[model samples]
Target: MRIGIADTTFARYDMGAAAIDELKKNASDLKIIRRTVPGVKDLPVASKKLIEEEGCEIVMALGMPGPMEKDKMCAHEASTGLIRAQLMTNTHILEVFVHEDEEEDPKELKKLADNRAREHAQNLIKMMFHPRLMEKEAGKGMREGKEDVGPL
Candidate 1:
């Protein structure tokens, strides 16, 4: 499958790189396409181009929004556009974001971003080929590097 990855250059960490590495390791045959934008707000446009122009089957819109309230707002706005893009293209765009405020420690935040990115890559794999794999995790939070948490 042709997978699209869109990330923000303004992020404090390289979450997109992390996601891409995981995807390559897990599924070497996947044709991975990437776009690096300036910030979270730019991800949707990049995603649209990836889907409409590049012919990617699915897109992963990865970002690490800062702790600022404005950062969260921008993330939400980008997600809305991403959703619309998915509808317009009749494709899936996984909106994966790990906010800086999610963890108190910087190291912890990095770990969270890495975990989230890797998890999203796995999700993409399941969505494309082995959909039954997703059903196994249905209603469960599969937190990477941590034991599976029961459904909330």
Candidate 2:
């Protein structure tokens, strides 16, 4: 399958590269296409192009919104646009975002973003080829610092 990486340029760190690396490591046989947007608000259009024009079955939209009021609003708008694009194209765009204010320390935030990116890469794989895995883990909380709630 063809996958698209629609990442933003406004991120202070290289979350996109991290996500792409995870995807490559997990799904080496899949075709990967990349398009960088100026900011999170630009992800929808880039994702649309990747899906509608480039024939990508799925898109991984990566960005890190800064610790500002406008940053949240911009992320919301981009998410709304992504929903619209998904409905129009009948494809999935997995929006991966890490808010700068979510952590007090820079190192913590970077680690969080990196972990989220890798988790979403696994999520992308589950979405495409293994819905059963998603269903089995639905509504399960993280009990011991682990992301999953164990197998069904």
Best by TM-score: 1
Error of 2 at 100 (Å): 0.7
**TM-scores for every candidate against the unseen true structure:** 0.93, 0.90
Clashing pairs in 1: none
TM-score, model 2 to reference: 0.90
Q: For candidate 1, write residues 53-110 as lDDT tens digits.
A: 9999999999888888899899889889999998989999999888888889888888
| Stretches of model 2 off by over 4 angstroms after superposition | 142-152
Per-residue lDDT of model 2, residues 42-104, tens digit only: 999999999988999999998888889999999899889989989999899998888888788
Worst 10 residues of 2 by lDDT: 142-151
**Model 2 residue-pair collision total:** 0
